[model samples]
Target chain A: MNLSPQQQKIIEIVPQGAPSIVEESLFEVRKKIYPRAVTGLFARWRWGMVIFTQLLFYGLCWVPWNDRQAVLFNIVERKFYLFGLVLWPQDVFYLAILLIISAFSLFLFTAVAGRLWCGFACPQTVYTEVFLWIERVFEGDRGARMKLDSGDMSQVKLLRKGGKVLTWALLAAWTGFTFVGYFTPIHELWGEVWNFRLGPWESFWLCFYSAFTYLNAGHMREQVCKYMCPYARFQGVMFDPDTLVITYDTERGDPRGSRKKGIDPRSEGKGDCVDCQICVQVCPTGIDIRDGLQYECIGCAACIDACDQVMEKMNYPKGLIRYSTENALSQHWGWREILRHVVRPRVLIYMGILSIVVSAFLFGLLTKSSLQVNVIRDRGIMGREVEGGLIENVFRLQVMNVSEHYQFYAVKVEGLPGIKLASDHVIELPAESSRVFTFEVRADPESGKPGSNPISFEIESLLGDAEAHEKATFFIPR
Target chain B: MQKWMWILWPSFIIAGVAEGIFFSLVNPQELYFLGDPVHYSAIATYSIGFLAFWMVCACSSFLTWSLQRPAGEVNARG
Candidate 1:
């Protein structure tokens, strides 16, 4: 390898043992962050949410409904059962609507209180909190964990580290099992687990999901929030000046200096902040809140709690760091002023759109037809001349009963004159089941002209007030 | 090279082993040996599916790496 003149000059100027040009390329080495545990109003609220969300997730899969799981998305059967409502493949639009609603809700929330979902309800945040709790239980607090890592490898260290990993693995495995149980019936899946008879896909998903949970929640932690989350990247666009963010009041907190207890900060030309870095220590993403709002902040409000506690101890007013809008902080406005701006144009628009979408979604779901009929013209032979000078069109009808009870449907064909069904007009369908049946439609030979004729199939459920109408092209030979 | 290996090779091996375990357990005979002895077409389909899986894993791994990397930021002193 020959070095260019520029490379030689660069090497000469650069110090020895420092990162070389090639080594100092784009990729940066990762330094592990040990977040200290803090207890405050926001921390308690986060724990409360963690408990509520985890309980709901782990409990939902076990609850039985109509002798089966209450919320099962049986992909193999291509049916999604939600309580009393059974959504067939044809009802996939409802799922799309649900996703749209979620996205809009996120937009509304971000416009109001920035990153509340990331802080409170996101699965990554929730699982990481749970895993951290488990780790704390096994290997003391943040300081202890850091010391254990820095100290030489020892018996006690191994035991504590091993215990943490084992606990994390168990929790991850249970989470994975519950995830798979959604697609497969939990009770049946449990029986399979006991008998060691899980099918290949089931076992694969179980291990894959478990490994992912373990690696992500236990090891990856805030890294999942910082780089992997697209929402974190795009959330800035949704933010406004009036959006409530976890902020440090630089005006009140700057000119910060270390002072003894009972020393008036104002008299000493110092701000309320006592120069304690508790806020940074408690921060999950390892960013200082005093440096202004950064994109890495999940807005968990841990810094608020930590700062408030320090203020209380120092007899200073609270909210040295608190949730305030950028506009409020800049304008020196009180809480009432900030609340007034919360209902600004952007918020109102989002709320209006969200409400309309939600209402329409509800209306669509409530008025969902129980009967689904799809008519497919046989491609191989479009139309044939059967005996008796009649034109016959072979068609396949896919009838799906989206209800929970057996229903008989009567099928009728109408379009051109003398168009009649050649097979059984009335068919029985099992609950939440779909079947494809091939039947022939015959039209009078002299009634229709050559080319494709428009025809319609009317399926009326005999069991309920549910019916469906589907149109298909009926071809006729010249 | 060592640093790159630390990120790439371990992840590659883990993904490969995981895929092997899944395939061996699932035994997707239909995907790889449909109606006949194992043919090149069947192998091609199976390989394509595996390639798709690896691509997804690579994307996720890259995201994780980028997030954890230290950006040479100087810590603020108050």
Candidate 2:
């Protein structure tokens, strides 16, 4: 083997049996993973998740409640309508709480099961699965895909690739459209799209998001999980010995060698693994679980399903590779023991924090006030002497009815000696609407000191007992 | 390629998160520029704001990565 001086030095620096560093670092070329389709319990569950999430995302914006879109964020109108409840810009507290809830939920989920979200629920994983299904539909399974990629350029290959790409693009476009639909009214958006009248920003976002979906799911594949995702990087810290993760039972499946089916492995002094490499072939990340737990493992358990079939065929007990904790695997513990160990201190702490945030979020949502009010001192004019000997302060009141029913609110002012509203005392507001009312509040000339007097407005719904108390300052000229 | 990704990718993600948090708290209609109300639509505000945020974040990342290079590489370049 002829080697340059630089190559010889690199070989000396690297440990024996490691793949040549030169080959790996030169281009950093990515080998596309052609994950073979596997059918089993986990596969079924994955498909179920794909269907459930896709249906919810694609179909949810079309649902109407109370003659309005049920869950429209409505960025243009600056309102968030969720079922019977309406949230204004001032309700950003709920959004913060929702984000906190999601973070804690992720923590708790990760503590209990290693990468369960990555395996079953992450958008990256789910989209990849959907794209793979489309690929299989158009180009056939792993073997066919590999063959086509390596084979000469042919008419059949081009057609197959074209069909797959077209389908993937359509699905991606729909995904992006549905996402934008959540912010805008879906039906109205459909009308605009059909008329070729999409707003510039809307069109830009639609294209940007569609391209993102195509590149990430179709092209990047495991690269997103292995490199791009921040969650994947930090999730290792949350994992413990008791966390359920995809693992290969090395003690039971060792001295791996190919053997005929139905042959008892004990007779030849071999383990269950037949050196089939089926697990590697089915891996989305192209990792061998028999090498033990790796960060690259998303815990999707396709390897487990693949191994179980191999184990069953070889007249061996299943679960050569399966979902088992580190402690369970090493100690040879049963499911009951594994369950007992899962409630450790780390998991309990995560669970406790998650429950607290979730409950706080729910409580805040349920007890949210039905009416909101903001008092703005009219900037144009200040204290004025009215026809009478009283000092009056001009103000604008922004009142919002956050409920689903129309009601008349009795508005009054107080908090200073004889401070009374000079504007109409009663204002009617439609359901889920806000209005700015300009009103004047008068006070006795000698009320407290002459500079500024504190005042409060009492706006109470006449139909319901809901009330909003807003504070404002009234100025009296010296 | 790897160095470019180290700054660009993470900053891109952070910019998206920043946009979400900022927009949720402050409505575009209420925004003002130089004492005059911003006349752009909500989508335009969000898009421009996101891009502005991405630039700021990417600048910070670029500075950090560039400064933290190995002494050998810096000396070699010089």
Candidate 3:
């Protein structure tokens, strides 16, 4: 490829003598990134997602469902309650389906646009942005922060660093509390924390989570996204030429040179770029976008805002750097044409699978039963002869009430003549509780001739108005 | 080498004891020993196992510190 004079100049001006390629040496220290703040449409959109995701994550733990915490995954109780759905261990397949659905959705979105989740909605980016904002408030903007970090440790520096650390610690602690709130009841957990009555395990986990949040978000920051995150490594597999990414338009911005305002740069054989490095200054990863797309770029579009502002000041059209596909940038295709190719067969298939999985999940949730029953026959003994000429078999019945209200279940046995319950037919079961009862089934000796007989046990809840039936075989001596 | 191993060995023993304790607390039904009449022996065995696991992890720190000497030498030369 033949580069234009402007391209040659840009190639020349980009920090000479630094290693332009990545190396495998493990001991290399990372350079600090001091990204200047910028405001634009995409920036606003990123902030909106930050607020939405954080609110849902932090707020959902406090929402009450029935008399218990909503969205609780009680591993100890072996139950997951989400809104009105009570998922027992047997329903774990639904979680697998949910994960598949989420994966397919990610694939579909990545096919359309590259790294949108990483730029906006990822926990690392969102929480890091929040922690940076706090740091900015306590210390100052990028320049002030750089100066403070390099200067001697004075009282002012101490106060600023102390305030920032304290704020970060408080946020990390609150995040940990909210996370534990999903497993333990938030209100009760709060009481325990306030009274210092937390159990050993709870205290350990709270401290562990808080430390992790503090280290990852406040200190590690972009290092986590760059080196530690698996997504950065795997994102290449999801990207295609049609996937939209933030790119610099090298063609229009060639023959670059600095010029005064209102000067005809193109007439003077110069490009419209004016050789301003605003884009590089505003990048969060400290990489020059003009060097082409690198894995370090999270596609936050801060460079686009910075470049557009520079273009506006120079009285030129904006989008010297903008979100564009490789094909569109190289071939100058219209957005609608690019969008048409974005919904290709691969993306459509992913979308179709995601929709089916989501529909199946919703259908399962809507039609789920509020009652369940399990019957276990005693293995120690076979059928026995009672004094009343009734053959008896011992069985244990576990009746679970999944409804919001208490239920009285009437147990009934069928498929044999003269079948009777050993105790009262009705058993009171509390809401969200399972009760195990050992009962005897009595039937005539001639019900089946010296072999196993198929029997059905049915439990009907009066409060929930639901019925559950379980089938088991009653053994007879041959 | 001998000094490093000595520094590492105690941490390994402690880590093993900690892991055993954790597992027994999580699933108490899994612990068993042959010819152990008293249950106290089982408890003591679990405690020792957990302490050994913790010690193993902690002992690895000495190994890491020893390995860093080469990197430090390289930086000093540079």
Candidate 4:
């Protein structure tokens, strides 16, 4: 780990004047990144996830569910219908728990493998990759694209630019439409769009989201990851020396210099690195892997793929730049030690909590009642005495049928003797709708001390499968 | 200050108006609904009041952004 006198001097001067250097803030503006394509294990894995995720997203909206959209977040109706489960607004806590779980999962993943989500599964990464692929197809590869940008305004350049823009715009618009389809029914939304009958809000959001997609994915690209993303900035906190990151094996690769192919590096006392710059060329964020691990490296493993290819060409062993921890490279720790560190207490706890939360959510969904009853006491009148010497309390019952089919529920009162329904006992609730019914409950005055008597209402479905019980207080005069 | 103000003010107004129109159309009935006609007008008044309040908030944010110094200057201060 010894540094040369010149390197030591450079290191000493770096900190002393770093503040003043940074204060100027006028470094060369980063050129647009044209990440060269590479093929390897991780690259294939990334593409696999991209296809899998996109298929699930696009396919789920079209899946049929009992004469309705398969999964609809009917925000207007304050209900979310997902296959068999109907989630009311009151069940929004589940969504909050889901968000918490996702956040913890991010933390856990980041701690284990630095920025794995950013590199692989993040929507930003996935969409940007797609957009870049399209750009490559229409405009050509990285070198061609760079050349096109530098060229004069010609018919050929215009045609390529025009075609790329049109493609990007269409894809971005479709993405936005698909996003809105999650809230509104996709088929119905398509019909509405086709007929030019899209609502004002729908139109606005469609345009807004489309514009954002175009700007962020198509134009902003790596700048979004490098500068704008809060995750990139704060992710440093989650990183440790043991965390797996895309790193250069400086010990093996350094004193890095250009050499002819098939040359013996050991005899020449030269390092294995041929200084081809393929790793930098393939990097989406326009970073040099040889510069050491920085926040900009998303651990995409493009460098690994690039370096592997270079190593193969040179007849050298691969992994000059690979997914490895500092401990692994520095201390030459084995994969077993790395695995032990990865599955430590923090990750285990996150996994345990996530499992419990997911199980509880599933259990709640499974055992949830399809019929719900909510009682609202008439605010105008408290309580009155009937001609039969029975104390009466007026209540409004909002009965909701969360199921797809019709349900008839028989309302019954408990917690007071001789209490009877003033109206018909049986109430029929339509599918996916609430029914308001005003009914009076009769109880003996001496049943309870009088100011407020605790009462429970039980609504049992005539089908006998689903039942819901709600509690309320009934006021009785002294 | 003027350049930043010009950029921020329009965006603020645009976003505010867009969000307002969006939420309004999404739940028009809920926005207008009141228990009774007498209560309806009262609720409408309150809704208008809140709408104005939000618009002002948006404008004030624009102002705040405009009043702030340039990033280079801010960093120099730090």
Strongest candidate by TM-score: 2
Q: Which runs of model 1 end up more than 4 angstroms from their true locations?
A: A1-28, A376-396, A413-423, A438-456, A472-478, B1-53, B56-78
Better by TM-score, candidate 3 or 2 = 2
Q: Which pairs, if any, clash in model 2?
A: none
Give the TM-score of each candidate. 0.78, 0.87, 0.80, 0.83
What docking grade applies to model 3? incorrect
Give the range where candidate 1 chain A is weakest over 10 consecutive residues by summed lDDT: A21-30
In candidate 4, which residue pairs get closer than 3 Å at backbone N, Cα or C atoms, i.e. clash? none
lDDT of 1 by residue, A1-478 (tens): 8988777755356567976654354324457878888889999999999999999899998988888789997754556788878876556678778888999999999999999999999999899888888889988888998999999999999999999999999999999999988878889899999999987667877997899899889987887677556688799988999999999999999899899898787889988878889998888888899999898999888889888999988888899999999999999999999999999999999999999999999999888888888888899998899888889999999988877888998889999999999999999989878899888999986777798999899889886579998999888998
Question: What order do candidates take by lDDT, descending?
Answer: 2, 1, 4, 3
Residue-level lDDT tens digits of model 3 in A1-478: 8988877755355666876665454323677777677788887888899899999989998888777788887644556788877776667677767778878877877777888888899888889888888888998888899999999999999999999999999999999998888767789889999999987667766896789799888877777767666578688788888889899898898888898899998788888887777788777777789888898888788888888889988899999898899999988987888878887777778788888899999898777788888899988868888877778899999888777788888889988886777778888888778889888888888877777999999888766478988998777665
- In candidate 3, stretches whose alpha carbon ends up further than 4 angstroms from where it belongs are A1-23, A75-78, A387-390, A417-422, A445-450, A476-478, B1-78
Q: TM-score of chain A, model 3? A: 0.87
lDDT tens string, model 2, A1-478?
Answer: 9988877855356567966534233225688889999989899888898889988888889999998899999888878888877878888888788788788788888888888889888999999999999999988999998999999989999999999999999999998998899988999899999999999999998888999999989999898898888888899899889999898888888988988777787799988789999999999988898998888899898998888887777778899898889999989999999989888999888788878878888898888889889999988778988877988889899988888889799999988878898889999999888899999888888876888778899999998658998988889888
- Quality of model 4 by C-alpha lDDT: 0.80
Which consecutive 10 residues in model 4 chain A have the weakest lDDT in total?
A: A19-28
lDDT-best of 2 and 4: 2
Ranked by DockQ, the better of candidates 1 and 2 is 2
For each of the candidates, give the backbone clash count: 0, 0, 28, 0
- How far in Å is the alpha carbon of A199 misplaced in model 2? 1.8
> Model 1 lDDT vs. the true structure?
0.83
Q: What iRMS does model 2 reach?
A: 2.7
